[model samples]
Target: MEITEVSITPLEESRLKAYVNITFDEVFVIHGLRVIQGNHGMFVSMPARRLPDGSYKDIAHPITNAFRLKIQQVVLDAYKEIISENTLEKTEDQKQENVAVQ
Candidate 1:
């Protein structure tokens, strides 16, 4: 299965960075994945649901470690690209402000 598309929406809260939606083979879609900042760094959290027992369970996940890693890598790559774009924009804005002040 090929990941046809990925959409990331950035957030501004602690730990949680963004929400992710991925499409597979241009036919299947999965939502509610999260990009989180942990102690080590950023990682992807799979979509999940709250069970009746008050615990959360993954709504969908890869069965194999390899597949899980592949998903994480793809999502993380997209997330990094977005973050870099935002950072570049912010840097440019700062430069413009400095020029204005000068």
Candidate 2:
């Protein structure tokens, strides 16, 4: 299945960077995926549920390592694009403020 779309909601104030939803073939969609900041930098976390035993179990995940890597790459790349755009916007705003002050 081809990934048809990816939607992201960026977050602040925590290691949880964003929430993501990905659509496959423009029909099947998966929600609650996450972009997380970890010791290794950033990675994608599949949707999971907390079990009664206090451990987490993935609710939806790719079965093969290759597919898992594909999902990770797609999610992380989208997250990075969002961050880059936000950074550019903030830089533009700063420049406008500086010009107003001058």
Candidate 3:
């Protein structure tokens, strides 16, 4: 299976930086993955649910480390692209405001 598409929704005001959804082979889609800002750095988190014991369990995850890394890389790459685009947009808006003021 191959990752056909990745969607990112950015968030502010927390360590939870964004939410992600990835599509595989243009058919299968996984939702609710998270991009978290951790002490080490940004990382992809698998979708999980709170169990009865108040612990979290992954609802869906890759079985192999290779596949897991692939998913993480793809998700993180998409997230970074979104962030850069947003930053560029904000900078452009600032430049426009400066021009208007002048």
Candidate 4:
């Protein structure tokens, strides 16, 4: 298991994006994430929904203070773990696919 690449894509006027590729055994998962800054320095959240009328609102309880910090730590750790697992799986799959072709 390993991390082949970590990439981020930015949207105009939005916070920086987060991209992670994770592998487990012989399977890999790619995830796209966005973390937005909140009013409090210690708080950050991901917006879940936008009103049709055109208003911004967060649907879930924000990650704030110690909670936000903890969440950040967890996310980082998860990203690392997922990458290794996903890489291994993805590589194996590609190998098999190539073998079958030949």
Candidate 5:
């Protein structure tokens, strides 16, 4: 019932902020969760599949709002950490590039 692990991968595309994978109690794992920047700000999207009728269906989702919020908070925190790490790496790379140019 507790979240044991969370992994986030930042992306460069628009709207989509990152991809998330979470493990519960180190036994249950869910993949393909998304961190998205929506009109209302950041939110988590559950894993979904395209239905044959041209509609999308969630493959996995929490039944309760409280549970969903918990998952979202964990995933967003991980996403923020990844974003900061990526920013630091990019800054370092830019510094190296500047040195080379000098």
Candidate 6:
């Protein structure tokens, strides 16, 4: 998928809003993230939290070198696999004279 547009808006006294391109012509808005420090020797994790006022929170864990590399590899592999599959599907569709309407 191609990322055609992106927007980040910081709300006054509130969380930020992020808009991302879903597909070539599709877009989506993102809820802001809430980051927090973890226990045990600076251990970090992305976890859900309940605020003191009974509100939900999205806690983003800190990124370590190992974790970052792992995540990058995972994302790369998934994207490569998806692209290969999409290319093969497109080829097959062309062979079968099947055209998708945009």
Best by lDDT: 3
Global fold similarity of model 4 (TM-score): 0.41
lDDT for 18 (candidate 6): 17
lDDT accuracy of residue 8 in candidate 3:
95
Worst 10 residues of 6 by lDDT: 14-23
Instruction: Summarize candidate 2's per-residue lDDT along 1-102 as a digit string, tens digits.
Output: 999999999999479999999999999999999999999899999999999999999999999999999999999999999999999999999999999999
lDDT of 3: 0.96
In the range 13-86, model 4's lDDT, one tens digit per residue, is: 43442443332334544353353444553122433477998986754432456654654555555544655677
Q: Candidate 6 on 39-81: residue-level lDDT in tens?
A: 4221112235899999866554324677544433443344445
Better of 3 and 4 by lDDT: 3
Task: Name the candidate that leads on TM-score.
Answer: 3
Q: Write the per-residue lDDT of candidate 5 for residues 8-32, one digit (tens) a residue.
A: 8888889998888999999999999
Q: Sorted on lDDT, highest at the top, how do the candidates line up?
A: 3, 2, 1, 5, 4, 6
Error of 4 at 36 (Å): 8.8
For model 1, residues 2-101, the per-residue Cα lDDT tens digits are 8899999999899999999999999999999999999999899999989899999999999999988888999999999999999999999999999999
| lDDT by residue (tens digit), candidate 3, 15-101 | 999999999999999999999999999999999999999999999999999999999999999999999999999999999999999
TM-score, structure 5 vs. true: 0.92
Full candidate order by TM-score, most accurate first: 3, 2, 5, 1, 4, 6
Higher-lDDT candidate of 5 and 6: 5
- What is the Å distance of residue 83 in model 2 from its true position? 0.3
Instruction: Flag regions of model 2 displaced more than 4 Å.
Output: none
Evaluate model 2: give its lDDT: 0.95
Q: How many clashes does each candidate structure show, in the order listed? A: 0, 0, 0, 11, 0, 0
